[model samples]
Target: MPDDFSWSDFIQRALPLAILGLALIGAPLLIFEPEGLPRMRSLSKELAQVRAENAELTRDVSKLRAEVRELRDDPAAVERIARGKLGLVRKSEVVFQFGKPR
Candidate 1:
């Protein structure tokens, strides 16, 4: 209300409030800028990929554990693996070999 008031005085009083307002509005925009958004999206995609890989690894581990349990509890599994992988036959079984004609 004083007649001696000037524009500089008004500016001095309002500068702190102006800075506070700009900080409040700009901080979030700065954090969510174009570059920041893409970086966040990339990170989210990588996290999802890692989760999928972890799930696949977990399934593989479970399958291996089940195979181990089957081999420990059942002798048939070992025989099957030997016959299929190693081509082993019983002692009395006849083995035949076939060759392609030249």
Candidate 2:
């Protein structure tokens, strides 16, 4: 409507506004529509589960390493494992088997 109005000037102003509008709309669409918050939460939960499992395995490995050292160096440790896990006894030891009463 104004004399200064031309297609180039109109396009210059309208193009930036259009791009800004699309950015405003598309930013939220990128975050909240399909693969955003929910995916992040799922990944976070999986990471936590993996970290917890890794910590548990680390503790188990440490215990196993200590047990291995003990078994290698201490004859008493070997006997304890043999007696507890394999139900072994010396030839002179007496055996006792107690059953639960119903």
Model 2 agreement with the true structure over 20-85: per-residue lDDT tens digits: 999999998888865897788888999999999999999999999998999999999999989999
Q: What is each predicted model's overall lDDT from 0 to 1?
A: 0.95, 0.93
Best by lDDT: 1
lDDT of 2 at 35: 88
So what's the TM-score on candidate 1? 0.69
The local distance difference test score of model 2 is 0.93
Maximum-TM-score candidate: 2
Regions more than 4 Å wrong, model 2:
1-3, 6-8, 91-102
How far is 33's C-alpha from truth in model 2 (Å)?
2.3
TM-score of 2: 0.73
Stretches of candidate 1 exceeding 4 Å from the true structure: 1-16, 32-35, 98-102
Residue range 1-102, candidate 1, lDDT tens digits: 789989998999999999999999998898799768778899999999999999999999999999999999999999999999999998999999999999
Please state the error at residue 56 of candidate 2 in Å.
1.0
